[model samples]
Target: MRSLTEEEIISHIPELSNVTLRKITKGYSFDLKYVTEWNGKNVLLRLYDLDLSERVQEKVEKMEAFKKLGVRCQDVYAFGEVPEENFCYTIFSFLEGEDGEAALANLTTEEQCAAGYEAGLDLNHMHELRIEASMKEHMAFIQEKFEKAVERYSRLDQQIPYGRKIIDYVRNNIRLIGESRLVFAHHDFHAGNLIISQKKYAGVIDFNRCGVNTAYSEFDKLELFSSRLSIAFSKGVIQGYFNNRVPELFWKIRSVHMAQLLIYHMNWVTDYFPKDLPQAKDAIQYVWEMYEGFHRTIPKWYEERQA
Candidate 1:
């Protein structure tokens, strides 16, 4: 996670040779983000270890895929390794907007939901890139995760809210989860990674962790992160994705997916992010309340608003 020198970066990305280079603070990943003028416009230069060329190439292709699918994102201009450094860099069209998470807090309930809907529209477009993977493969991966959750559930020092019920729901509904379409998920599609310009979803950022997974799986992160910021936005995500016709089966499948994740959530937060544990715990409780003790399928916000 070391920062590259201005001279080293200039040598690699000549476009930034004369532009003002300023390091941008990062939240989670160790990847370095630099803000500078490219062609007289503010742009972001993201650099990461190029130890695995294939992985880096895959990410480049994924970012490009968004453009083909008509999803607005930090348009990637160039991606390749530097001449003398063991690092790869990507130059992006720095979006002009506020952090989507922060922007949601200032909006009215209706405004927040509209923003969520806009996100869903873009997300639906992003899912258009169909990845070729068998349902069996996804099922196997979920099965492996479920087995690990079961083992961890036994060893958890503190009980998750209604832990046993949620576990049972997962076990009972595991079969339904095996069948899903493979799509490239934003991986981190919550409020944190979105850009809100003038109360609208301007674009998405942080595709470093994007991967091919069941489309329904993307909602899990929203359930964990974005929903904590605003439930109106959370409900909008689902409704807008489905175009106001959310299916009965989607809710069932969503509940099952969330239940499985909740199994290991506490230990994961405490073990990995001890400082954020209290907030994470509160978020989990809010989730518990939202799902009505994991008894209801549709989250309360969406359900109560249903006509």
Candidate 2:
């Protein structure tokens, strides 16, 4: 909620002059400031949460590549940690327009579908990047992340009928999804992270969950969102992404995404779970239902995709 003072802005980026700084985001890990000048040029200053040095560097690189691929994203101007100041900071050109979440309320379902499609194409383009030798190395990190989630899930106190089913789906299908020879993925592709200007797609934000991985991972995330909204809408986004029928590996990818989400939500719901225990109980139940619901559909979904 605090805006950066003019003196603070001048001190942080000494070359930057006569620009006004406004606070934009106060999300979990980063504080975002949009620095604008009288001429309307602007840049974003991101002050990271305490102790996330590695992630900040990695995220910047991902955004850089995405920009080259014609994905609308901010270009990084600078990043570093000030030992004296005790904060790791990054600056990027402020992108135009509001976030997708802000714009979605005004868009028709059809417009949303088109935006989703554009995102899918961008996502697919990123996935098409060839990194043959490094595939295994990159997937190892993804596997490790998922493994930790699985381990965490195993430690949860809640007993849900769908947990074992979700586990089984993951164990059975990981190999198929892993066989992909694609490049990186934006593992957290969702509407909230996308930026829209006018009626067209502009760019995406938040590459924190990004890494070298399969294209299917991106599809999986989109499909899950679609399903949450509406199966028809999900299908529309899928068509935009693939431009054809869903791939054989899609179900496997879906299972993996599901498993990952289940574990993630469980960990999330636990760590910062609200004081309202019943709400937490309902959340747990909802995730369990998602696990059960998706598990039952895998067989038919895979069959349809195969056909």
C-alpha TM-scores of all predictions: 0.89, 0.77
lDDT (tens digit, per residue) of candidate 1 on 218-263: 8987887887678788888888888999888888888888777776
The true-versus-predicted C-alpha distance at residue 271 of model 1, in Å, is 3.7
**220: Cα error in model 2, Å:** 4.6
lDDT of 2 by residue, 94-142 (tens): 7687666667667676776677677667766666554545666666776
Q: What is the lDDT of residue 213 in candidate 2?
A: 65
Segments of candidate 1 deviating more than 4 angstroms: 1-3, 149-164, 304-307
Instruction: Estimate the Cα RMSD of every predicted model relative to the unseen true structure.
Output: 2.7, 4.7
lDDT of model number 1: 0.79
Model 1 misses residue 141 by how many Å?
A: 1.2
Ten contiguous residues minimizing lDDT sum, candidate 1: 298-307
Backbone collision tally, model 1: 0
What lDDT score goes with residue 43 in model 1?
88
